[model samples]
Target chain A: MTNSIRAEWTKFRTVRGWVIGLLTAIPLTVLIGLLGPLGSSFDCAGPNGAQCRGNTPPIGPDGTPVFDTFYFVHRTLTGDGSVTARVGALRDAEPWAKAGLLLKEGTTSGSRYAAVLLTGGHGVRMQYDFTEDIAGPSPDEDRQWLRLTREGTTLTGETSSDGRRWSTVGTVRLDFGERVELGMFVSSPQHLETSNTFGGRLDRGAPTVATTSFDQVRTTGAAAEDWRGTAVGIDPAREHEVGFTDDGGDLTITGTGDIAPIPASAGSLGKTAENALVGAFAGLVAVLVVAALFATSEYRRGIIRTSFTANPRRGQLLAAKAVVVGGLSFVVGAVSSALALPLVERAELAEGFFQHPTTWLTELRLVLGTGLLFAVAAVLAVALGMFLRRGALTVTAVVVGVVLPYLLAVASVLPTGPAEVLVTVTPAAAFAIQQSVEEYPQVAASYTPADGYFPLSPTGGLVVLCGYAAVAVVLAAIATRRRDA
Target chain B: MSALHAEWTKAWTVPGTAWLLAGVVTLTPLLGVLAASSMAEGGDPARTSLLGVTLGQAAVVGLAVATVSGEYGTGMIRTTLTAVPRRLAVLRAKAFLVCMLTVAGGTAAVGASVAAGDALLPEGLSIAQGPVLRAAVGSVLYLALVGLLGVGVAALVRDAATAVGLVLGLLFLTPIVASLVSDPDWRERLLEWSPMTAGLAVQATVDLGSQPIGPWQGLGVLAAWASAALLAGAAALRLRDAS
Candidate 1:
């Protein structure tokens, strides 16, 4: 065994390709590792931006500021038993007005009004009374408050007791797609002859209030795209809604009509990038086949005898071949990873780049681990080649071993046990290493995400990857020993 | 005629050739079906079903490489050459035999993949669909082309281990590079020009417009690679003395 190892080492060291391949793997692994971190960023809003910016203040249909500026003012003025405030849209307005208007209590009236202002086809009125009530013989007091928002035909009303926690009070649907108005008016039924005004009431003026805050107000997100005359149906029964953005266009689904809304976060973007990598990397078979050919090419030239004569032990000859093949694969894998890093990193960065101290570790794991995986695949190829003692046979076995599990993973056999186990343990395990999301439950046993976990923990994936490589290596070793080269 | 008969007999008598072909027939679609089934449970059935093609092509490539490389490893190439003095004729004969066998095996494998994919996929994934049909048929052709590539590479390298390594590197290196590269334009170019990347483009059922190369064009790339390898191998065989 020692002699064989030495012989293998000698052969590997002498091959120029092996040296070049190793040099390539190191940088490639580093580069590919860098892609994930470069693409991600630290958002103040966790995951999907729930806290970032909830809603926009409304705007006029013509794109002008509806309410000048929100302010809180205090004043006192004499008034009758009732008062009225008039609110309406500006002239030459297109159809609807969108904005947030707040009315708060001032010192004069000693009354408080907490409300929002909005106007559209769908509208609602929300107001709450803040004054302490007298027991008896008191006139009923009615205060008008404005609170509303409009998005296309939909108008939403909100109420807040402590500004921090806001809740929707009610929703109203209206056919008014055009301009509308809103205001408050008060009236007193008593005539002048019926009673004289009291000293304090006659001297004082009407109460004044100020607006506290206004934000995210807009009037433009109301037009839905017209899908008339198009072959595609807007809301077909079979269609799956993927995403809807008032920013660009209407909601679009896949051609087959199944659409799932993609989460708006770096994690989702990372998964997308990873999926693309998996799809692209699936073509690695071509590379493995080429490597296998090189390993077995000597047999076709009647050089196996010469190779065996030089090495003496068949095991040594096979070991040398495995080392050479695996070494080349490692180089190729490393180079590929390096080149992919910048591309992947840029793609991730486009979403939002974040700096994480742990990112370096993740990169290291991905690059080196990926290189090792490819190396194991190469070793397996050599072992298969040796076992079959025929180039085609070895190639077939290796390809079957590599590719069959993937197919079986998708095949619909009655009992899914064997297939599942096969997929979980094979190249699928290798893929699990690439995951940035929680290891999928069915395919991964020991790797589970934490509570409220978002994506795959990078470290856990590395462990699973190591497991895959170890298995492949052990299998290759066993096959090499059991089979004739 | 006698030499052709002898070659045919020799190929048939080998247990490895039959076993390899059988594996191609049974394993390709079986794995495709499995992948499709697994994918259908959670994700897209068509995409999952076609997943096996990626792995199956590797096997096909291996099979092709072994066909030529095995002879080299066994030190029988010299004997075969002595029997048939015309090196080009021997190469041509080998190519013809391998192509015929690969086509037959590839057809079976592809047919099984489609059948299994259709059977194993979820109810919504219809194999009768145009894209699915294209993927299935293209997969067969893809395997055949991969086999030819193996044969050519094996001929050039003349060492089983080296030939396999070189072919796999050639096939897989481009996509890896394309993936790792940061520039979209460069990545797009690499993906478009890479033989395997271009060839596998035929498997895409979604977002054709976004593909680096058109499906037919991608297959053309693989064909070009195969032709080049064959030409190179033929030249090497003609120029070099047999061991």
Candidate 2:
């Protein structure tokens, strides 16, 4: 058995095609992973790791800043209340630039807040926290009256095209405090530069300022009767950059600001860690082709006779081949994933994207788990080859089983429920092994399968893939034992 | 007519032909049922139910490739040539037989897929009407063209692996590679022209307005691809020495 295992290893190493495939799978995996984030060209100066370790508002778990920065005017509200403002047109606004009435927990970026705001170009939008963007009616009126009413933690947004009849936009339940900042605010992101090329924004955008005025500002809720306005996010060094005047019934505010670490979903892992596994599909395809050919090529060349004649025992041959292919794939997958993840994380950080750094253990699991996924997938591919005895068919089976489902599930084309079901059943379920981000119950998000979630835990998903592989191997063993070479 | 009849018998007589054809019929609806069963409300039932065509095409390609390449593999091509005398007629007969078989099997598979989808879909999905009918019939045509593509590519490449690789790669990889295009216009063009993307468009009935190409137009693109491959294959057979 040892001799046959040694012979199998020797036979595998001897194949130039297999060696080239393994060698390419590594760099291809890392490169593909890097390419996704690189394509986005993430640019931000939001969170410094050490500064965010404390998870200060605006700063996320790994010190990446959540979008929490905005000027505020307030009187501590004890109970249910409302703030109404007739918002004047914003000047030099961005598409996502916002100015409207808001009820916020505090001055921090990630704190719970919901606002009915007039956007620069896309019309009215209702946004809560940092993730949810609910579209409201696009009334023809340029100036609109917006109201945000709070009842417990639930905030309802209303917009009036003519300040006479208010129409409900939407309401979101948020976690908040009794002493909340409720008032009107204005913000504009950096000036965006459009590329002549077709891909995403290639240049880091320049910052721009926007000023918006509010007329007939009034409060009816418990905290709104008496109001004091203060600019919370104004850096002392950058004094006079952003300000608000709340004199009597009217106010004007201006600033070049946005909640930091803007809203971009890179799986649940965010941009920082999704890079770790982005190349996984690219690498897996190469591995599938090589692993499948490892079995089928012998049949194609009619060397199955020679292989069995030398080994005599079909089970030993299968076992030895499995070990050799599995070990080789593991090594290739691990090294490539290791090289890709760190390089991508660094590049994202340099590009101004803010992120909480994954722990060493999380990183280790990411790299090693990818290795295991490919290893098992390769073994499965080999088994499929034994069953089908066709290079194209077996590779297609494994790819359809793994890669295609992963793509479809993540395409955002399928709705949440079906996408989740897809990930649960297919070998692509193994992808859950690489998930490092935990979904918080309090956070409002899509939380769909397309958003980097598996219905089963990572280990559980991997177990699903393992189940298919075990079946294939058992069938291969039975056929090899019973059939002629 | 006699040559066509002879080719018909030749294709099914090959090992695994019947099972491969059966696999296409069984797996198509089985996968379609699985997809349809898992769908949420408001989904285009026609598209979701016919999703199995993506997998079904694999078997269709295999059947067509085996029809041509299996003879070459067994040195039966020499005997086939001796029997027919005219090589082009033999290739034509083979293509016709494979296409007819694909159309027959594809119709069954697609009909089963729709029936399964209609039975399994949670919402009101009418399989008996409108774009659904076009989708079902067009899917059958799509498979036939893909089968012809397999036949054409196999004749050109000769080796089973090489031919299967070429056909499947053209079918699957073009869309993937095209997706990397940053410019939306070019991406749309790439998708519109890609054989697999355009061919599969026939299965899309729900959001016809949003599809890159119209159903018939997309199928036309796939047909154009098949015609080109067949033309190239014919040229190869006429120009190259027969083993």
Chain A TM-score across all models, in listed order: 0.39, 0.61
Q: lDDT for model 1, on a 0 to 1 scale?
A: 0.49
Off by over 4 Å in 2: A21-65, A69-279, A335-364, A390-392, B1-6, B71-93, B120-128, B152-190, B224-243
A199-302: candidate 1 lDDT, tens digit per residue: 00011222111111122222222222231111121223322321112223211111111001111122222233343243224334544554455455455555
Q: Per-prediction DockQ scores?
A: 0.17, 0.06
lDDT by residue for model 2 over B135-238, one digit each (tens)? 89999999999999999998897655546655765676555544443335555777799898888787776657767798999999999999999998888977
Name the 10 consecutive residues with the lowest summed lDDT in model 1 chain A: A194-203
What is the C-alpha lDDT profile of model 2 across A1-485, one tens digit per residue? Answer: 88988998899889886798778888887776655445543222344533322322355434444655556666656678888888876645776677888777766556666788887776777877655667888766657889889888788999997788989899888767677777777777666542211011133467566787888877875543555655655554554777777667678787556653433242222454644566667777788778887888788778999999988889998888888898889988889888988887776555444455568898888888889998999999888788888876786677778866665566444556666888999898998888766664322234544555578898999999999999999999998889887
Position A215, candidate 2: lDDT: 85
Poorest 10 consecutive residues by lDDT, candidate 2 chain A: A194-203
Highest TM-score scorer: 2
State the lDDT of candidate 1 residue by residue for B1-243, as single tens digits. Answer: 666666677789877678767777877677677556554243334545655566666667766776677677667888898898988888877777777787888877777776776676665456688987787678777878888888888888776655665565566545544443434565577777778778877876765776788888889988999999999989988998766
